[model samples]
Target: MTRLHRRQALRLIAGATGATLATPAIIRAQTPSELKIGGMLPLSGPAAIEGHQVLKGLEFAVKEANAAGGALDREIVLMVEDDEANTTRGVIAVRKLIETDKVPFIVGTYASAVVIATMQITKEYGVPLLSGGSTSVAATDANEPGNPWFFRSWPSSVDQGLDTANAITGRFGAKTVAIIHDSGSYGYSLGDQVEQVVKDNGGEILSRDTYNAGEQDFTTLLTRIRSEKPDAVYIGGWAGDGAMIVRQATEVGLRTQFVGSGSMVSDDFIELAGPASEGFAVATLYEPSTPNVYGAEFGKRFEAEVGQAAGTLNSLGFDSTSIGIEAVRRTGGTDSKAVRDMIATGLADFPIVQGPEGATAAFDAKGSVDFPNFIAVIKDGVRTLA
Candidate 1:
């Protein structure tokens, strides 16, 4: 079934008392024995590279939490599933985690489309879900009321869109631009926001186009964009696809400046695009090169555990899991209702791990974190703060 249809069905099955029903006597009775946390991620699909990085960060966080004496004096157990970046698979993975594993709190699914689709299952089971990487604005839109079980650890695309637009026009002095996206929910929503920001900032959108995720060839789209001869091109997609577009744009002689959203900051993009990635600009949240106390500490811990420097996905994963653990501790137990209430009502003042930006993470009423946005450029195939 389609993602929308499945969400509708799940919502119907949940009915009005889904929240109360989800808190079974068995769950409350078993909370004292073990504190189980569930997670879902792409793991084996188009977004797997990003998903795996996020999972590693979560694993490291769980390890740290356990070493620090665990939450509420109970050992924490993390269970994960592979969503494969597919909505149907995401539904199944989340269901198994919520029902079969009986985890009260879950984290995961890097792709915004997967998060959007599987969130219904969390609502049905009354499990709180903390987004590890998804950045679509719709993920926490206040208009869609009733589900308070959702929260985001990263800044929304709205922040990235506004940052990119301002950087393109204010810094680069671009008057017109062409846009391309992945045609998935994340890319499309971010692209739409950037398009509006462009217009609002006294710039013209020369052309707009989209490509499906995992598509390699972009000659036709690049040729069409080249004809418009915009001052720059804005890309709203993941690293793999964005890298291909940059390489092909070079081969086709599309000479416009390329600016991208946060997803373009991955090492995958730099490795795939090689020399073509130079001079590419992106609006992102975390810049490892920027010296900060939190980044330094997190970098050391992450390198010790995963043997690599931390990136955006890794930082987000660590922060989200840390926040969830703090909420559980504050509530004094693993009751889903109590944890959810703490997150919604007292998350703003909760003392947790600082974000990569070296600021204490605070959540607005919408469950979105307020963090700084940064502009970076690819210099010698490496992303450096601009």
Candidate 2:
């Protein structure tokens, strides 16, 4: 329950900035005995399930790094806070980490809205943020001219939306589609992109609708969508909202092909939707079937640690943390500016853990990693790569 006041945070940032400018030699000369990375996740809200999985992935990575004599011979520690999927809470969490815990780098924030809100604070504090699950293009774009402190370890929502549109039109031969999304930042941004991609590919958008998060009753939205009678329905939300939509769509007798964002590939959605989840397609960046020794070993270790198979976001958390640790190791110190520069410049060609697409993790100029998005189908309550 630690909170950082605005004045206190600003004062800390001012002090850190002054120190960086006044004594560059002293900043470089000081080598920290241990490395502490901060994390802000929705560990107590509707997104808690996914958030906990992400936490496990981060913890597993830290455990592995510590087992191997730690990063730069300094033990790595993770300081986490529960964002609760709220913007205000997210900002407070980031502030507490930056000013209170004094971590040089942070990783986490599953929801795009949370990441967007927290990144501003990290930028002000001159700390690097390694995002694990926030896929909004705007998250990194907000950094503007030169995003030296923010890095996204996942594919952009724009790419995922385009991939979903291509799969629907190309594989399913759908000429018309309807779009439904939650009212959150991630859903709205991704839904808008998906709608445009569908239109660009010679597909007509029959209808577009939105619902609020934590809404259990989707009958009203489903009824309107049923009236349009599009060939397919695209869900631009997380697994929980996606599950309710699928189940309600079935109840309303709207038998259209259902496709979803990467968030729908989780076991929670599959189990919650039951038979309704069958034949559902999801565009995702992580494929557990990645053919690489590193991927296989990571998957095995993740399952052994969490007692369940790893999902896309789990792998994302692992990659984001691993890349951050590599940046810290390359810098040979815990200085935030040095780590940020190394990540921005040296991260592109450096080899880290393999992503779901079997590609080595690399960051672009905008701090986004390039990875292929694949469409997966849920068959008999299991997600299979399509």
Candidate number with greatest lDDT: 2
lDDT of 2: 0.77
Over 240-342, each residue of candidate 1 has an lDDT whose tens digit, in order, gives 8998999999998999789987877767778888999999998766656655566667767777878776767777778778878888888887778777777
For candidate 1, report its TM-score.
0.88
What are the runs in model 2 whose C-alpha is more than 4 Å off? 1-34, 352-358
Report, for every candidate in turn, its global Cα lDDT versus the true structure.
0.76, 0.77
lDDT of 1 at 139: 75
TM-score of each candidate?
A: 0.88, 0.88
- The clash count for each model shown is 0, 0
Query: Once model 1 is optimally superposed onto the true structure by TM-score, how far is the C-alpha of residue 278 displaced, in angstroms?
Result: 1.4
What are the candidates' C-alpha RMSDs?
Answer: 6.5, 7.9
Q: Positional deviation of 335 in candidate 1, in angstroms?
A: 0.5
